[model samples]
Target: MTKPAPPGKAVREIVPGDSRWAELTHSDNHRFAIVPDRFVLPRKGHQVVAALQDAVDDRLEVSCRSGGHCGEDFIGAPRRNLVLDLCGLNRIAATDDGQRIRVEPGATVGEVQKALFRDWGTALPLGACSAVGMGGLVAGGGYGPLSRQLGLVADHLAAVEIAVVDEGRKVRAVTARADDDGELGELFWAHTGGGGGNFGIVTAYEFRSPAHLRSGGRILPKAAGGLNVQKIIYPWAMLDEATFATLVGRFFAWHEEHDRAGTPEASLFATFFLHHKSAQFLQLMVQSDADIDVGGAILAEFVAGLTEGTAVFGIPRGGLMTWLTGTRYMSQADCGDVMGARSASKSAYHRSAPTGDQLAVLYRHLTSDHPGQASYVMVNSYGGEINRRGSAATASPQRDSTAKSSWFTAWLDPAQDDLQIGWLRAAYEEFFAATGGVPVSGAATDGCYINYPDVDLKDARHNRSTATWHDLYYGANYERLRRAKRAWDPHDVFHHSLSIEL
Candidate 1:
């Protein structure tokens, strides 16, 4: 059974011409639309659940939006529907003992980091983009540079507070966890790696913080080394497919070897960014928390192997910026504000390394129709603790797949939407096909990364693979996610083109 929708008077008042309505309608990453009839930002979880129930009874489609970063039309859809904006519900509550932190779904990862840093020198292992909403990131199985040290963000989840729709236009507030409540735990597990806004509305998340260590009666010394950032840039035209493949493959191999050797260094993080243009270029960021010399030595060896007469140039170091506590929300806010202002991004994951021939094809495509903006393939290494956990232990289904890498192509020209999108899609499809469509099930490819959500894989118009799209993203857990969806949002009130289907 569930509680009925609250009376009309309880619903936040709104009129069609109001500024708030305009702001809400135009607020997501995909700015394009099917505007909603009304939008509400309930301050409390119970209030939101009640509103969702009422919207369901009215036969209105509901779209859950937080930070408006669900790429594509998930947040902007079906004009006469209702938009439940949870961004205003941001709140961070710590448990009495301080071992656990409870966060509202609307809270940004940056905010969480800030809160943790303020209370204690603690932080959650989340994506590098601070502006990403915690609700969506955790739900989609978050991974970042720190992932090598802490595993997926979902690994630390303790519980989730969600609003489930049930029994004839009613909603129930349920606390789902792994212990003391197995049914609810399953729901929590599903949400951990399952795509966002598909099952139910998650209002809050409870996570266990790492324990603090002390020496004798005093706290252990603060970490000694400063942050070091190394930048490596290579001209795009100079890099052919073979060079790119060698660069990516060698990096992955190095990361794997280091992980097996049990060498964990907080200062170690590597990323490769490609810019698509006449002067196409590759930029790599090597971040280390160790002594600059030691970090440089390790990085130099890796870079030397890749740059051996390959036209690789520019090895500069960006000095450490201030080390802030808690999630870097201010930084992410800048991204959201920019994305909100106007931006488009597309992403994909690889299950296997691109072969030499496939690389040639990719190089041709990237150089042929290069967009003026900084368009390039960004690769981050996943080693250390990331591989220590079994794939099934968390909702991130890609754990078992050999697709040890994820890549993205991002640029900032709103006017070039069609051209840019088409280029990305075509290149991605060609790459996937050449690699045996590793992202599709039954192909050597395991699944796609939920964080880099691509609607094409599921759209019959674009993807013709025999493998069902959902299986590639959720693996064997797709069925379980469906069951939970049936249990919580049976009517499929919360839906988008590529969201989990019941």
Candidate 2:
């Protein structure tokens, strides 16, 4: 008989016929509903060690899931049936007078944000999706509205606690921290943006922003007193080809020029939702902390500049709202049950505005409507203080990017998957055709975002670039990441499709 969990602890093994099997095996993408032989849900770090050891003993391929938000089948790794669902390990703690925060892998973004603000008056640059887990997010370099001002969540990662299976097939735990310059430090650096499921199963993280270290207080980043948000829509019906081109061109130029290391523009962040014509209106959303935006003048002037020489116009903004309320509102924009929504996403890091040809491609796609699918192109403000640190400082190397983008499409019908996926690929390929069907790091594009993994980049059928898949995701940091992988995961205990190869 298997050893039982320790007293006051609960660990469950779910199988195909178990009552909670579907829940445990479900993926957010729904493209691949993995039917693992079993899933082990553990509530503590020790339990993770035991579960991984069991999987290794059984000779079962292993994979891990934090929030199941990855749009691909990486959690299943296509065929790995022994899944380690970390959702039950959720725990959040703050110590050293709230200056040192430790978050368990399974904690949700919303839960972490609430805890940080409620007790410490601190915040981290996390994604907008509240239910997204911190494990994969932090591992993939967390980015959000606050990122332009505060930098990536991984940028402040002080330490990582992980469980690994050694060559002896015995599981062991190790704590790697940033302050150390030894082997452990390299492991810690790998987690900063190396993407999860590569090195090992992370159990916990210690967050200490540079500001926190320098001042010995104020964990993460300072919480803004309030936030001023403006959501404006541009009716596609009123926009001509020339006007649409101008609107997008200006938006890109603005972010590129303002994305400096240290500047007041860092206080402002924006996202352009260029939805397909089926969605009626394309939207522009901009936000800033009230502490840096007095009387909303910064937002007003910025909007005005965006609309200059275009048919678009800025809408009047309302007064500021408390940080909690504003963040909640921000979360609401992306919250909901995305659980069985069949979706696909491709990301690009733009060092410069899309050329006129690229803008034409965007305009063409936005005007044409697909009957069975939904699609949109999102351009998000990136690179302010995020650019302050060089590429070698962390595994996330897109430090010189001006803006980041996501070409997305979603559908509910199983039959519509082909339609929606093809729609996104066409748009994405055409927009990046100049770079050989992928965003190869260069003068115009800075490769892809690891957080938004697209296996298509690895398929020669789609990607015509000479650059390998690793080149697009890790850029110049690929070699260092490979070395880190070899040093840490010798037996390849933890791995996925895009994980650094040993």
Candidate 3:
């Protein structure tokens, strides 16, 4: 929670009883706050190497945290664990020609977005969590509001500087480029969507297309001067199963029909948030780059199409805001004080709309947020530029999905853990009941998004599908990611519950 040490300040190790230790120990996810023995705040990549070497020298387990938004307790080992908080390494440097921009692992989504927009008039399609670290987000194939138009943030990753340990336990910092055509190239490919904490600790990433995306100009996509964002809220108070189904089906149907890239509809994006009826309203947030959509006509047309035949109408909430301002607002409104509450998120990518049986399951649980608990099911419009890439081109292979959905719930009290977890688990499990309890890569559902890692996918009791957790997340790319893991982190210096196997 505390700001990282200022530049040139002495970076020190914080131990138990140090006032700073308590502040730095807890991650954004409050449920499983790590209890590492030592915490090191590294100001530079060399500092990261220094901290890592000490761990290797002492034969202690090492884990690195950039933004602490993993929402899982996977950073440090149970025994003697040395935790490296890379927040101090925050830096975003751009090339003189502006064709390349290198972002340090510690830079946040908000910081990166602001910097890119202000300096080069460019932007990355990062998720809504402003506080999320680029270290993890980009590495896991970052996607968000602009994703449908510009592709993923990972699609722009050209190079990565990672601090890895060799077989001799010697720490070395190496920059893996996409064109190396060797182990380094494979390493870079793995990082494209392999997720964090698997290969090694990432230091800095240069933003440019791994593949030759264009003839020339800036490597990243330019956001239309700002954004045209609008919020529409539909009252659940007036909704019956039929009405709800109409609204939901219409939203997905519209996306499926107009999912093609490089069109006016592709410029528009929407996130349909279905909150538990206890919240009283379902929200549909839409936005389009002003540069392309002009007066936001594209956005308006898309909204109208989603609600055309529905009996219910959605009332506009916030009129509109600038891209940066509206993005900040969306992040805050969607995830209010997440650091103060404990939350669980499960995700899936849908190749097509859900069946009637699945809609009934959604209506059943959504009607009851469980007395004191709060929950929401969010479906973000997908396809477009994201689907243009071939599946095997990168480590993240979920490129054919139309819409991505996230099932989430948060509670303040520890006592509600079982109630909240149980509710969300049932919601997700029953939704994919036809596939043996998991969103197997099939006709309706493509697979799960790796960024939204769920350890539950690994447990047979929860995931009763023949498809392993590997198939649900990585698909055919799992084995390739494993090869990179073995080559880079042979000793498994960095690991987590769902880290790729060697």
- 1 or 2: which has the higher lDDT? 2
Better of 1 and 3 by TM-score: 3
lDDT tens digits, residue span 1-502, model 1? 1122357434363446766665566654544654776677777887787788888778887777666666667777555567777887789877676546788878877777667666655556667776778878888878765565556677777788888877565788888875734567678888778878787898988886322322222211123234455566776666666776677666655664565312544236677665565545667766654443354566566667666666545556465544462113112244423454434454544444556666666677757756535445566766455556666776776663332444344455577677666776776677777433445644335657776666677676667676667766777888878877787777777787777777
Q: What is the TM-score of each candidate against the true structure?
A: 0.85, 0.95, 0.94
Write the residue-wise lDDT of candidate 3 on 1-502 in tens digits.
2345547656767778777776777777678777777788888788888778978999988888898888667774454488888998899988566667989999998899889878876777888778889999988999988888878888888889999998898999999987788899999999989998888889999988533334337667765667788888988877889888878887788888888887778877889999898888899988887867888887888778766766778898564577778777666332653547888989999988898889999999898647423588999999999999999888889998889999988888889899989999998899889998888998899778878878899899889989998898899999899888899989987777888987
lDDT score of residue 256 within candidate 3: 89
lDDT by residue (372-411, candidate 2, tens digit) is 2257888999989898899989999989998999888877
